[model samples]
Target: MIREPTKKKETSVTGCIRCGTCCKKGGPAFHLEDKPLIESGTILAKHLFTIRKGEPAYDNLKGCLLPSATDIIKIKSQKSARTCIFYDEESSRCKIYHKRPVECKALKCWDTREIEAIYDRNRLTRQDLMGDINGLWDLIEDHQERCAYETVLTLVDEIKASKTDPLLEKKALYIIQYDLQIRSSVIKKGNVDSHMIDFLFGRTIFDTLKSLGMNIRRKNGKHLFTTTIPSDPQPT
Candidate 1:
């Protein structure tokens, strides 16, 4: 007896398969076109974070970490994981599928041209969203100035060149402390949401330094650098 021929599985090369690979990598950065979503409260501020200008971040197109030219507001990933906060792992779907941001909409794992074309264009920034808010914008501006990565990186270079210079080390420590202090002040006094701290001031300086291979720890009430700085440090 002849057996029935085996049926081939169906597959498509176009469109998303809901594989969740992109979401698991991390959320997409917000573009200017996505501003309406935030303004309309469809995407709340607490669900997002910022990679401040000059901060080192991974460039999807370039395929390497580099200093960002402008603010890159992105959906926050789940705590202790790179998975996007909006992704529903149980269902393998996006919670805000319909109201997803431009990046999410443009992304097609099968065809990346659309996402790459607009990935780095028209990025939405804190100024665009909150520039009109009195007092708040001023605070954000001040924070950016005080904790600028350019300044911090320069200090790191100086500390590295003069390994035994206490002054250079102290300056770097002070900046880190100030970064931490301002976040606390905003949360307690300004009544800012704790979750917004990362967006407001980027990641903590301690985390940034650690990423650069410098380990910071407190001993006897003094912050000390425990690891030798990398000879050729990348921005991150």
Candidate 2:
């Protein structure tokens, strides 16, 4: 029998140990360039989740945590671990290897220049996915514009401006819980997937408020919003 030659593996960047650490760390952030994979059914909307603008996320360029200024679409991770959903531990391979997102394809552990170039670029927004269909997109936009974070911020600001008001605390609590329910209702309506709801809303009301330095306390086993650092307080 004649022997056949085995072809060598091709790698664009060096120092790939194939340990899958990057995949374990976090799923790849998707971009507009990745629409082809979705169109081809290699990746689906159900497989993705949104990280909304104004949420705390790692900024690789600055090497610090900052609010994401734009919406980001990312692959969901396995429930058991932070690894990419497509990652198979038993085989130590990507299930969608041939049609992986651009981020996965461009990643190079050693050089990483290609990946970094696309990391902080503009992301696909809900509107980006909108075609002629107005129903879901309209709902998404309405919910986003009316999200509780802004209302909470306004309430907090008003309270700060008038420190003499004693009723502000009660008002804040009412608004917080009300906003939470609003989100719940939208989710229950199912016009948009729950995961999609999360991304479009940015961080939840609790998280966004916390990031803004609002003091949270548990009262009767219910989270109560308390004081927040004044935007500008005159030094006593």
Candidate 3:
């Protein structure tokens, strides 16, 4: 029987083999904001399996602290080996198609050159942001490899602390905490409260002087200020 190709929605990329290859642990990761879809009632989360720290990870080399069975997609090609935890196989489509992460929603293939190019560029910014966040910390590990994303997110806060813009700072801090929540790293250390991160990052208004490009040279690290640090907004 000959099958007809259906025209897909015109977005960034197209064509997924439905193989769970990309969704497995260590393949690509999800951040805090992305978890809402899964936690908010996605079918895939219930069936998706995870292998923990010492256990053998999925085809992508990621272990689950609590791995369970999720939906599966039969793989037709070696390149897309392993079933997708989100596929409905019987229907030949994604189970969480509408709520899939940015990466899954943005896949590309040989026929979609322009779409691939667009996806590549967009993916780079996100990947680079993760890399940037990783560089900011020294205690990061590759576990589920999700920790580094939050660590680097701290950098967004480093800048936020110095800005006089409360909204701007809150937005940046929100991004960092929001991401940590998605990665499930929010509870890793020191309570992982978004409010706490916000408090710490928020209270750091000292950055404004730091960003002025006017180096406040300390005499042996002592503040030259005869007064105390400003509590209210200074930069208008």
Candidate with top TM-score is 1
Off by over 4 Å in 2: 1-15, 148-179, 191-196, 210-223, 226-236
- Collision count for each candidate, in order: 0, 0, 17
Each prediction's RMSD over C-alphas, in Å, is 8.2, 9.4, 18.3
- Per-prediction TM-score: 0.90, 0.71, 0.26
lDDT string, candidate 2, 1-236, tens digits: 00011122254556767788777766777778887777687877767766665545666556655556767777778897778889998998999988887878777776667776776675666567754457666756665565534555676677667753557767776655655665677678755576655544544666555555566676895776554455552210
Candidate number achieving the greatest lDDT relative to the actual structure: 1
Q: Counting only residues 3 or more apart in sequence or on different chains, how many pairs clash (N, Cα, C under 3 Å) in candidate 2?
A: 0
Per-candidate local distance difference test: 0.81, 0.64, 0.34
Candidate 3 structure quality by residue, lDDT tens digits, 166-227: 55444544444443444345346444444333211221222323332212333663333222
Q: lDDT tens digits, residues 16-122, model 1? A: 67888778878889999999999999999988888989888877676677778999998888878788999999999999999999988887766667777887899
Measured on C-alpha atoms, candidate 2 has an lDDT of 0.64
Q: What's the lDDT of the predicted structure labeled candidate 1?
A: 0.81
